[model samples]
Target: MTQTKKNQQPQPAAQPKPGSAFAYAPAPESRSVVDIAPSYGLFIDGEFSDAADGRVFKTVSPSSEEVLSEVAQAGEADVDRAVRAARKAFASWSALPGSERAKYLFRIARIVQERSRELAVLESLDNGKPIRETRDADLPLVAAHFFYYAGWADKLAHAGFGPAPRPLGVAGQVIPWNFPLLMLAWKIAPALATGNTVVLKPAETTPLSALFFADICRQAGLPKGVVNILPGYGDAGAALVAHEGVDKVAFTGSTAVGKQIARTVAGGSKKLTLELGGKGANIVFDDAPIDQAVEGIVNGIFFNQGQVCCAGSRLLVQESVADEVLDALKRRLSTLRVGDPLDKNTDIGAINSAEQLARITALAEAGEAEGAERWSPACELPSAGYWFAPTLFTGVTQAHRVAREEIFGPVLSVLTFRTPAEAVEKANNTPYGLSAGIWTEKGSRILSVANQLRAGVVWANTFNKFDPTSPFGGYKESGFGREGGRHGLEAYLDV
Candidate 1:
């Protein structure tokens, strides 16, 4: 029974095993279904046109470093044209009966469903997320978001804000890259449902899907100049947000950028809403279900490779079950398959870009430098891609950069808490208030803890579950304003 006795018992030959060191067969999804054009132009005033200065930039696949297409870059002049178009269309668009606008949104949602497979494949190809995620999570949510907002279009009169809220004309929206098309849906759907016209700029790295969305707008027979798409870098976004023609500015990206946009729109008449970053905490109590809690932790941080704004990057586990939970987590991580994103079986895919990958690497290295015990499962990344192994940091302190900053990658920081009060305090310590999760068997404790977590969203037993009917936003520096449901209408309306 002792260590000496156990060491003397097992002696086996070193031989080839069945499942040890197994390699996944290459099962790449066909790109033939997706037809990437050689070049693309700005979608302004319901037509594709060149940049004012004819400047163009190339977009590449982060996974293979292959150039996907050349897209026209928009400058101040192009932004002006798009804004003018949206403004010109706003009068009629907003004046239309809510029923007509609702019908258009309903049509868009139906078309998105009909073309879900094509859109999913295109999103997976343009962004670095796995095909499974694009097909299952992102695309379905995109459609549902449109569908949910469509119903709200005709019902805004009875909403609590006021008897009759007026639409904010010519909304300027900027979206991030993590959930490209989904973010587009989130921004544009609410704006349109409120009868506002939009001039949106998709992230430069992931613009193809948004341009495809422009095609959807045309197919839906959305009025000319009602929706405009501009694909460009930050300068174009700056121009769009600062243009006097824009009455509302909606942005979803970094906290720094959000701050800058806030400053730019300060003292102006433009209304703004920002959905920014987070360092979400997944707290596991002593009396929690260990197995289910472990699964929640994994889904919390590892979904979308932890590129989520509300990812549970910080794990606050009770010291009693810390060892058990971490051991099980490490074992479960070892089974995760990471490789080509096109592979349906791949669990983790490429990083979104070289710059983001570098940021993640630097932050992770800082974690090790700050004396946290860094660990990653034994996994092989492809030679020709941007990939980071699923990582966990144990012995992490409150002051550690990884624990405090938004690493925004497939990295989890594990910290221990002695009591529920300490867990709530540690979770609330961060400036971000996007989301948090609590795992416990006690019903009263879930309510007690959820009430004090200082986050916009709280999940008692599960993690990362989203529904279109639920309004989502954050507090503090994580940014403000709701994105879904009845409350979302306030941002785009004169409530």
Candidate 2:
């Protein structure tokens, strides 16, 4: 009969019994690899120096509430000192050949790559994001940012602004705690590449990585005073923003603070850019690939435990398949492991602080009080540190506070639309215009929806993707000024 035998698929691997026998063994990364000192001094004029007033604050690991180190608290006087140092360094730093600057940047990028493992471990320990994310996303992006801007250092003349572009005098930068090193990269890389010296402020809770970066500056033999780092609370940041010597200012934090900086620098000669908050919308159509969409939904909201400014906190599903997607997403959420940030298998980690956790709880409570359906996966959180179970409110509407506010935690507000036009309208109803996501099988629809979106960044068929080469910022109240790519260079140059 000449019939061919049917091809057989490989058999599944055997699974162990459901008990300690099948449990994943603890594979925590060694904490000793990172040398967190008992206390750290401010990085001023390229050297570690105490605050002028001898004031210092403690920084602790959010995961364990363990004290990491004491950091110098910069006051108004320290901010002035840092600004003057930057201004003085600006002359020589600006006069250096673009090629010379490129060398320094390239050296810094290589050092970052070499010490990436140590930095990754430190980031996880301090930031409460999983080691997997720090290793896979943050470190690579940080190194790439320096490398990307390094190429731009010598090539600015040909960047199409003009044949000759001049540098801004001194850039004052303040980065948030969410992605400390990456935000620092976004601020420092282009500023340095464009021939400006910088005075940077690490958030109060997270200052160790930026302090380590000062050591990198020394390793590169970067000129003294070219890069100054101040680790302190909001008063220090406010003072830096108010400093008269700084020619340019860049900040990434909450919208409230961004608005305050805008008001503080209003009518001044200083150039400013603020990358602020978001309530991104992740929309799924009936024809979307359901499995991939579910994964994107989880990643968009739950990544970094939803600490990201551009996290997709709002989910819009087409009514035709809304129930199907919700069912699938809830099932997927149950599979996620949430616990120790150092665990290689952990999908979610601790909330950044008790204050942030309380905010999340209050907003979640509001969702339930306003008659929305509140649901969370049954997961155990460590009692020692701040934690919030990943949650979703399925009955949210545009009128609800949960749908309007930026929770800045791992909480999703689900809304449904019957058509693409309605989805677009509902998504744009919010005051935020930071980022959005759309998933559909139709190519033309992707283009159409994206064109209608007011957000600065949009993703189709994917979520939470970033590149050093792409420009990132927001529209409306989400704040302004692009932070990456060729556009970012313009913010630092006087063309």
Question: By summed lDDT, which 10 consecutive residues of candidate 1 come out lowest?
Answer: 1-10
Candidate 2 Cα errors over 4 Å, as ranges: 1-23
* List of clashing residue pairs for candidate 1: none
Candidate 1 residue lDDT tens string, 1-495: 101111112224335478675655556677765667888899999999999999999988888887778999999999999999999999999998888998999999999999888888788778889999999999999999999998988889887878898998999999999999999998899899999999999999999999999989999999999999999999999999999999999999999999999999999999999999999999999898988998999999999889999999999999999999999999889988887777787788889999999999999999999899999999878888688999999999999999999999999999999999999999999989999999999999999999998899999899999888888999998899998878888999998
For residues 86-180, write the lDDT of model 2, one tens digit per residue. Answer: 99999999999888999999999999999988898889877899999999999999999999999999999998889999998989999999999
Task: Give per-residue lDDT, candidate 2, residue 282.
Answer: 97
Whole-model Cα lDDT per candidate? Answer: 0.91, 0.91
Lowest-sum lDDT 10-residue window in model 2: 1-10
TM-score of each: 0.95, 0.96
Q: Which TM-score value belongs to model 2?
A: 0.96
- Looking at model 2, the pairs that clash are none
